[model samples]
Target chain A: MEIPTQKKIEMLETMLLSRKFSDSLVELCKIQGKIPGMMILSTGQEAVGSGVCAALEPGDVIITNHRSHNHLLSKGADPKELMAEIFCKKTGCNKGKSGTLHLAVPEVNAPCTTTVVGGTLPIAVGRAFAQQYREESAITVCFFGDGAANEGSFHEALNLAALWQLPVIFLCENNLYAGAQRYEEHTRVIDLAKRAGAYGMPGVIVDGNDVQAVYAAARDARQRALEGGGPTLIECKTYRCRGHGETDPQHYQPRDEIKQWQEKCPIPRLSDELVSSRVISSEELKGMESRAEKIVEDAIRFAEESPYPEPHEALEDVYV
Target chain B: MQKLGMGQAVNQALREEMHRDPNVFIAGEGVGVSIHVNPMFPTTGLLEEFGPGRVKDTPVSEAAIAGLAVGAAEAGLRPVVEIMFNPFFTLASDMIVNHAAKLRYLSGGKSSFPLVVRIKSGAGFGAGCQHSHNLEAWAAHCPGLKVVMPSTSADAKGMLKSAIRDDNPVIFIEHMGLYFAPMPVPEEEYLTPLGKADIKRQGSDLTVVTWSGMLGPAMSAAQKLSQEGIEAEIVDLRTLTPLDKETILSSVKKTGRLIVMHEATRTGGFAGEIAAVVMEEGFSYLKAPLRRVTGPDIPVPASPPLERFYIPGEEDLIKAAKEIV
Candidate 1:
């Protein structure tokens, strides 16, 4: 896949925005005592969200996991409403019902997020089945973590998608840790991509920190799905540079591993590649970073100013 | 009017709904070939009429079946999925209880989830504890789900049609014992609205509250009571979630005596719910103490004689009605 200069710059901007947005949430939790247990940041995994979501069209659907701020922003969710949603404000996307865990932005075609591991896999197949039944050209993208691969839903969803020849892309982000346990401790299969072949689908491994590689793999997978070739499983190997949650004690993750992954942070990596390749200058990269920082600041202000939902509002929306 | 079995009525409801809406489809294990051969099952002849795209035969994966149905319903399609038996519903409860039941509210009431899950319930076939447990109370306990259990063939066809057209997720439970029992059904289009109780027998001496498989035994007991000048009015609660408390109170007010009967075990059965409702709202009208007759708190036995004893029968209803009166 040939990368255009403008598209590369856009991808770079998205990755920076995701990093800034995620880091702001972490700061809010650590410094301001806001969103305590809800802060599950995807700071090091920005490239995966930016690359995969950029390849999707308007009508395509995305079913993501709990660590979903990057995917929601990359898929065109409004930052102000998303921030307000995390703050439990009435102006939030789901009217303060979902809070930070389950963010559903139907306008962006990202229907819902499930906090349960591997819960979105079978749903993605069903959404793809709907697309196929209607003869629509769009596909569904399902995102999960390394821990979800061991779930029974992973096997059942993959086999059903392949059996029905549905248009779905099962994108697994292997960050080497399922909450606190190491990935190796959870499953014997080191390379998660190999499991896709058992379901009669093509599985590809990509560098999750490299935006261009992730984009190329996602673009090809989307093309194959649209052409009626069934689903594809793309395993993006990455690292969680921070603890699983804001309140998580750092007693389990080794310090050396954290430093090593921080050195390969996706935002700075993308900036260096873009500058060295003459796609943009150092000043332009700095300008992009400042712009993203401003957006995050404005979102924070909007969330702080938003009103909390009334107590009586809780009784509503339980039924249609 | 024509005679139709409960299973055949269910099939007719599915066929008519599919013909009315193109987006309605059925998916389950052996829904295409295995179930179609029975001719009276709900999926019978659907594969032939709707083709393979709509009538999907899947692997024996209950979680996938239910999760996919939730996804499909979210994507603007009406999916009527099946969970083979009531006991197996536990395997798919995460999707049905966590996702499907909560999605609409999670979406802030912006999304309309239209899906129906047909679960076969009851123990008359002696399928043992795993396959024949009555768990309607479990489904009714959920806030977002609409639980419906129809007793007669006519009510089965009418309520099944209403459940499919409803915009909320419905847990439609059918008893295997009533599948082949023939009853009079109207040929013209009609529907039995959900959340309403039916007066199966209109007597005034006492009120026998029952539904689904227990309605048969209650009606038989009511017939025998009539010979002894003990009139028992039976209130068949068609839908359990959006319960028809108005009808129940009215029936109790008229009869002045109450007896709650169900096929499930006595502990934590839906009979407790009915008894509590009568105690709270209709206590002043009651002439005698309420009686509840239910299965013993034990797993359903597979042996024929033990199974017959395990299930609530007309004798139990008669004894309970006699005591309450």
Candidate 2:
């Protein structure tokens, strides 16, 4: 599908920025051992996070899983603060308490992930219920993997959201494989969107690699939610170029599958389009990539120079 | 003067609180109606009076119910959640641990988790292992949760009322053994503070620290000891979290011997904490070493014969009292 000029230009910029950031994180992983073990990268799925978050307001709440660094960045979290959190510096989003996957910045209304599978969905339902109770038109969007659909909490939350008519958008980033297991192997129901249909809400499937597509689906669902149209389920079919985390060998993914998705690399597809459309040239695209590299370097420098927290600081945020 | 059980006292408290606060309401698995009726039956006639929205029967999803209550409590409503059994608490732990307990602290003390979770506990009446467990220690260990276990009819009524009005997450643990047990309770507006102990009997020989169903047997043991001229002080700790250390310490000082008792397993029970407190505060006054007469370390068996020996009763209390003094 031919995308619009403005959409393509912005798309390439955001996706390339995500790719650059994650790539730099792997390098940081090499130098400082920052990411504890395996770090899941939205290298290919960056388009989905960037596009959906772009349509959200500051008041709207978004929650997701441990694979959530891109979501926070797209939701307007300061990169330096995010880097500080990962580095365990005092300047971090959770004051250095939370790392890459569990970042919560109150300013953007994006909270930390629950870390466990299928945890955030029910919590999102509660938040939406709270919003509705206050008679506010705010909508809550929950991001989870297709594996989460198999969890009871996923069903409980969706059922409650539908029953209460709570404003929540269940965004399933179906990256084809939940770790090593492919989606079709475990789930009898091939389509997760159809699971939403079982709850009496519309389930839409979209090209998660396409920023315009993800944004269109997200914005429409958000409007429907804000208008008290209950909950909608959007299954974004994407791919995980990176393993579950930085630690995974990614031996489970087939070579052909990886090659196929790499060809549709969200960053390059839109970048080439922006370059050809004259919205941006190949030189500017290269310049932007270099700029992203330097930005990441500065973040690393800031994080490395920042002092580690006091030992007692461990107990400070345990409750709060 | 009125004589009623703690469960009746709780029913009285509900009747009174519903009259007092329009925002106060009860909801849970069977608060309104059930196929087998509520085993706890704490919400009889409440659904009719308050409507399903207030005194509603939720689906068999404790997490959703608790989450719904947390949402309501956050948005200016007082909700009382009835978890049918203490074992069922696992389903609501997310709401309890993640949200309700941490909301006040997370919001920088700006908000209050004004939610009450009433759970049925104790293992004396043959409810099987899962249905019968005294898990109050879990709540006592939590930072923001206020754990209250009332032993008398009056205290149950007063404490439940206090819990409904208090701006904190309160777990009102009701002992199944004492639901029908009778005591004198006033039919008037009253509130027992969240963290205070009541001295059941005056004595000079020994101090008995206990709560929940154990309080009755402790009082009976104290009375029997009193008849023999060996005075035993009975201190009932109505609340477990902000434990009534002051009352416990004073009673220990007066009697010079402390014996803590509870129906929960002894390994990590709340009564163990009381023994620690007595040792910390009244170490010099002890006539003998502090002792804890508690349930053994085993899952509550379903057999009533084995269960009787498991839960501390009058005989167990008498044996402990005589052993100390």
Candidate 3:
């Protein structure tokens, strides 16, 4: 089922605005050095996080893969908390203990997010499993790259999820790479969704850069899971366009390939659709940009002023 | 009361806890996979009762399993994670030490991590170095972790029930050899609180303190020595972290001599820590310097004959006990 053209544009704009915010984080890494060991740039894969996160109710749980940040902000973690986390400030979501990699916000039910590949899948499955055991209607939405699908836990967890019909939406952002390695280099078959058939489940592949398409697919998958339709594998075909991590210079990717994907940037396309359909005037989109600029500006100040955690505090939060 | 092995005792404890508390859930590999290794005929039917949701079998992600348990506990679920191979505890130490142990304290005592990590440690059954490691001393070294090892079915049931109930992270280790060691455990609801030690055997001339699988050998040694008119008091330090210094020191005072025994190798073993405590606090009560009888400092050998040499036996305990007295 296709989402209406108008609603599609709105969702796509939200994705566009979020991508603008995260792109600022990347630029600030050069402007202010807020980046750390490995900054997982959301770059071209913004639609998956924005789309899946938009469809979820505030109380609904969402867990993201290592290539996160958009998932955090889209799910509504404090902008300051996310910025402070990337900057290693005590005011961050995990009190600076989680860093840019591992983060969580329990109040909104983003209890934890991990930097380890394929690590957050079982946790999302467990969170949903626990919610189901308690008879709550909250469905867990797990976001992972296509690379995570190749992990053994991916196979085991999805198989278990389908067998048990757990309330979870496995959102696969098929950005087509495991760091420097292309997705095709790892998996035996290119279409990752085809593998879901082995688990007796439906697999949907979509253009990840199309925010509304991603959103509609997420809403349908999550609804089915919450209503006991079991698990569905939705592969959002996207690109890593930039490097995998900040340290990932992406030398393996050819310049022409990067140029082509950059030309398909989701924000410009969405902004174009919004203006052409008269969903919003160009002035209105520009106003959203100015507002986002103010938010990011304030976020940067908060990150700069927040004090670093004491060395002793590093020894803390090991358990709770 | 029913006669049960250590494995059944643990299973019963888990069942009783889950039945009593809606928040309690047990997870790990092979827990629901026909209880792998044909480890027991008794725990075979538990999967049918609890189902995979509660008694989950994981995909060998030890770190993720422990970390997931931490998050679940934070979200208000009491998770008892079973680590299939005891030595694999090394993989989960980050969550266990950094997250589970320190989380409450770091959170200004606002949050409690009611997570119990169950591991079957120690060498036996020809499973050499990688599979076997007595982690009592290592776990004891951590401030936030509460370590427990039960040699008998009764203690296994009672202590596990206690560990599961305690509002803290606990590393409940089990010696593999004691899995089949049966004892009459209560069928009714019960719990043996942690930080309490039991005087397994009474004596006057010398005191022998031990735990885990060593409890058996130490007791046997004490019993065998009674014939020689050398009365030896045997105390089992069940909880390793909060060592029962009162029991250990009191026993050492009465006997005026102490001999510590452990399956872990001599240096840095749980016995060394106990010996140091006695030397520091119970020095005046000692008629002779404290002595330790432990496995030699070496990787656990696989050969039955060589393993017999590596692990401390009843003969070794008897000899050490006689020498100290």
Candidate 4:
């Protein structure tokens, strides 16, 4: 379960990159309103995406939910194209069709992101089923929020995945709140992983803010899935620091709760871990931050320079 | 040529396609069971031939079935999924309308969702309102979906094959009434292309455009109208979306009149779409106002006598055609 020092640094770097991407979006949104559509920022939950996606191979599939920019970045989706997509440019990953919420990067095996809660759970199972049918070693990882667990799709997907022993990892990023509704208010079951036992699958809970812990759990789940051990539900106890959307009001969440979660931010926590462990110096961590910032800046510039899709382009891509 | 029931033709199409491509698999309730043992199911004998891996029987989870199909299709497999009844399709509409239909477009053509959803529709065998509804209009209204309804054995075989090969998601509708009806089907390989209409019976007096379960009634009405000196041409719109507007307009140009018919309810039916097309493009060609012979705007009745009244029949088409002619 122990990750190498170099790998740990890389994880920290990926988390920083994801954070910088979201940070750039927030800044751009404030300055010029450059985003063509609504933004679903994955600010506080970068480790869940970084850790889970880091466990996946090149061919492994991951179906993500609406707040999936971090998942896409961690899965190695081109930041420039993703930024262009948010800018509604022709050079974007989805050719300006799918904005932030519905971004897809098939090159990285993340084909689709559903805006509907828990919608992609069964889809991930299906992909795993196909791989199992073909006897491929690839697995499918599904990322959803704690709120999505209440959806019928989540239960059905788990049941089928277990019944067929499909190679799928049902990774629940338990961000505590489902669009401002706290987990306690939404469901009686406080531990989402416990529900996985009902479906006859291993339920493992991980520290969502700890990159190494999340990565170890995801790695084990992926291994189990690929070996025909059926699906595993890995619940990462995380938090979404920002409001649901860019313009979401702060009336639902208390300020104290936000401050507490913000203090436990995955990026700084992992950076501190790396520094305290003497795996990297404080200066090295600062260098990684600047590198991530530069990447985000380059991506923003690329998006700004990209041309908008022609009016007639809207009629295209409806079919083959 | 071989005489086969519509259901048998559908089974044949699936068998041939599965045999031809290793990537094609079918999943649905009762599909894994032998159809000969269970006469009510269309996926007879597929399980025995294809084995459990290719022929899967899932729990009654429509949403999961649809989502699985989209996922499998995107992951490099051609999945043909079945919803036991048309009404049950509503449960899966989120996946069908939002995922399967929009994935290709949302991916900017990076993904091809070659998924086929087959549902049995229409009323006649006392299946009641829930099991006997035609929602082809609902499917055709979606821009990214191709809706196809086969009325005959040949069309059922041909269109199903074409739908499996299609790159986009196709909503393949089979009528409950036509399941046992026998018609001649060619043994040789053939495909009825999507977005094409078939001229069932040609005439010059008036054009009667219809499809699916209504084709038989429309043809019968056309036959009766011919005896009355109104030789009504029957245009079966095999594919609803990407409609064969050219054939419909050309038929109207020749006949100088149009009567659109369908088993779905009259209001907001696909007939209205066809009517609009004819009105917009063939306005000058119309010798009479566009007429429609469709089921009344109410849920299909459970009782046979009331159902008979609810469903548009040969007499209804004949009346509509007479009004236009």
lDDT of 2: 0.78
Is model 4 an incorrect, acceptable, medium or high docking prediction?
high
lDDT of 4 by residue, B34-92 (tens): 33474434798888898999999998788889988999999889999999889999989
Q: Each model's fnat?
A: 0.64, 0.15, 0.13, 0.74
Taken over the whole model, the C-alpha lDDT of each candidate is 0.89, 0.78, 0.78, 0.89
Per-residue CA lDDT of candidate 3, range A1-320, in tens? 75666555456555655676677767777754555656677887777787787788887888776776778777877777778877878777667766677666666677666655776676666667776777888788878887788776576668767776878888888887887888778888878889889988989998888787788888999899888898888999998887877667788998998889888877777778778879788898888777777777788799889998888886664433
lDDT of 3 by residue, B1-325 (tens): 6888788888888888888887988777767775364544324556788776677766566766776677677667889988877778887766676667665553334457788999888887788988977777888888778999877888888999899888888899887777777778887888897888899888899988888899888888777899988898988888887778999999988999999888988888888788888999999999987788988999888999988888888899888777777
Deviating ranges (above 4 Å) for candidate 1: A31-33
Error of 2 at B275 (Å): 3.6
- Estimate the TM-score for candidate 2: 0.85
Alpha-carbon deviation at B321 in model 2, angstroms? 1.0
Model 2, first chain, TM-score of 0.93
Q: Candidate 2: lDDT of B122?
A: 79
Task: Please provide, for model 2 over A1-320, each residue's C-alpha lDDT reduced to its tens digit, 9 standing for 90 to 100.
Answer: 44456655555656666777788787777665564444567878997888788778778888777788778777777778778877767766666555665666656766535566777776687667667756776788889998888878787788888987888899999998887898778788877899887888989998988777888898899999998899999999999888887777889889899999988877766677677768887889899888777777888788888887787765564321
Report the C-alpha displacement of residue A237, candidate 1, in angstroms.
0.6
| Candidate 2: stretches off by over 4 Å | A1-17, A32-40, A271-302, A317-320, B1-26, B34-41, B69-79, B94-115, B141-144, B153-169, B177-198, B242-250, B276-285, B301-307
Error of 3 at A247 (Å): 3.6
Model 1: per-residue lDDT, tens digit, A118-230? 89998898899999999998999999999999999999999999999889999999999998999888889889999999999999999998888898999999999999999
Q: What's the lDDT for residue B322 in model 1?
A: 80
Query: Given candidate 2, what's the lDDT at residue B214?
Result: 89
